[model samples]
Target: MNANEVLLDAFGRIHEAVAATLQGIDGDSLSRRPAGTGNSIAWLIWHLSRVEDAQVASAGGLDQVWTSQGFAGRFDLPLSQRDTGYGHSSSQVDAVQARPELLLDYYDAVHRQTVEYLQTLGDDDFDRVVDTRWDPPVTLGVRLVSTVADCLQHVGQAAYAKGLGRKPD
Candidate 1:
């Protein structure tokens, strides 16, 4: 497979893995911080989704999807707030909580949008450097690969947290 096809195939499995993790999470478990060590499942999901929104929007020379929605007003500082990396506000979390289906929907939207955008590119676009809003100078393809890596890593974390309940075996 070529680079784009390889990325699409790998991301397809990552999508299934992420969906398995999200579906296994009970509502209460979504807010648990796991001994106060790091972000909860909800926070992690928000972060991952937002990362995709931000990165792809940057590539397209548009604003991120989350910011346009005024998500900052949903602040859930201190306890559920994220400090180390991107996270959602309290309202954003509530929004996500209100619609469990939106979790998968958002993930699917970002993934599909990214793949479609990449499909429009030629081999030249793969090497074309773009100054990313979130990262330093890197080609669009490189940035996308990084985003896929991020998604895969977080899916692993969520799977481990889910114990024996993870699916798609």
Candidate 2:
């Protein structure tokens, strides 16, 4: 009924959706760009995880799970260590090839990290500013909410891409 509990529920949904979306999907299908130009399902999920990892880590003043947990090295794409898939080009999207389990494992690590971070916060903690780059500055609460929205949106896109039911190559 409290803020943390509510956040836990929302984040729990993300975990479930992620597991469902990636289930049984292989790497080629994951990386397939719809019509050969759109964001691949792989890229969407990866970006979603990256955004959550980056924002949550910043809000918590902790290290990103991507680097700290060796995901950057494991993924091993020829991208910057700080790459979050934001504004990545088509070729950049193509560079993010990953197996389903690898993506799921990375997402699971980031999700667990996010859960741990959320568990320690009180309602007042959400009011703390986490980013000051924006016009109004970003608070922990806004950052978390934005992350939830962005995550769900990307996951939904992934699901829809899957539903397009293009024959797996």
Candidate 3:
């Protein structure tokens, strides 16, 4: 498979895992924090979506789907339009309460944008430097991989939190 195809497949898995992890979860459960620490499932999902939206938009030189698509308004989050849940405090995490559907909708929107952006990139585009702050700088390929890694981590956290919220059968 080509690079684009590989990225599409990896991103597709993330989308599928998101839906599976959130399936049948109620709003209260989605927002529940395990042992009242760390992030809730809702926060994790939202943060993942936000990070993807922000980074993909930057890589594509396009507006973030969050603000452009009115997701910021739809969420009405206490945080600013620029917030991506980075270094969010416990109280900030607790503030991100939403139903599974909303979380999924936002994620779906961001994922769509990411796919569209990826479709526009040539293999050479991935080698373009997108960040210079790192010691070796960072390429589009590295940025995309990092975004995927972060999303996977958060999704796994969400899955674990979902399991914790479940009552013993």
Candidate 4:
């Protein structure tokens, strides 16, 4: 498989894990930050989506969909504010799950945009090195893998917090 295909598979798996983990969680459960933590399921999803959006935007040298997609206004926060700490109120959690379909739609849009950006890249684009706010701003391929890893890790956290099952340590 090609680089884009590999990235797509990684992204798809992470999305699936997030969806499955959040499927039956109610507002209370979603808002609950595991003791000593400050991130709820809702916040995690929002943060993850924003990260993906920004990563794609950076890769494509274009603005991300945070505002264009109406996410900032809907969430009453700036796209630049990426604090994923817990401390979510019940209302916030309720709002997130209220329109589950919309969340899924937003995620799908982000994924499509990312794939499109990947398509625009040549072989060298994937291998080109760059600096990012991330610990090690590496090649585009490394960034894609890192993004997927971040998403999957948080999804597992959300699942474990809900007592669904112990996410792999």
Please give, for residues 33-53, the per-residue lDDT of candidate 1 as tens digits: 555554556666666776777
Candidates sorted by TM-score, descending order? 3, 2, 4, 1
Candidate 1 lowest-lDDT run of ten: 75-84
Query: 41-111 in candidate 3: lDDT tens per residue?
Result: 99999999999899989978989989999999999999999999998988899999888998999999998
Error of 2 at 106 (Å): 0.3
Candidate achieving higher TM-score, 1 or 4: 4
Number of the predicted model whose TM-score against the real structure is largest:
3
Model 2, 36-56: lDDT tens digits are: 898999899999999999989
lDDT for predicted candidate 3 compared with the true structure: 0.90
In TM-score terms, candidate 3 sits at 0.97
Candidate 2 local Cα displacement, residue 90, angstroms = 0.7
Put down candidate 4 lDDT per residue, 66-117, tens digits, no spaces: 6677766666653234433345564444444424445556676777788777
Candidate 1 residue pairs in backbone clash: 74-90, 74-91, 75-90, 76-90
Stretches of model 2 off by over 4 angstroms after superposition: 166-169
Among all windows of 10 consecutive residues in model 2, the one with the lowest summed lDDT is 160-169
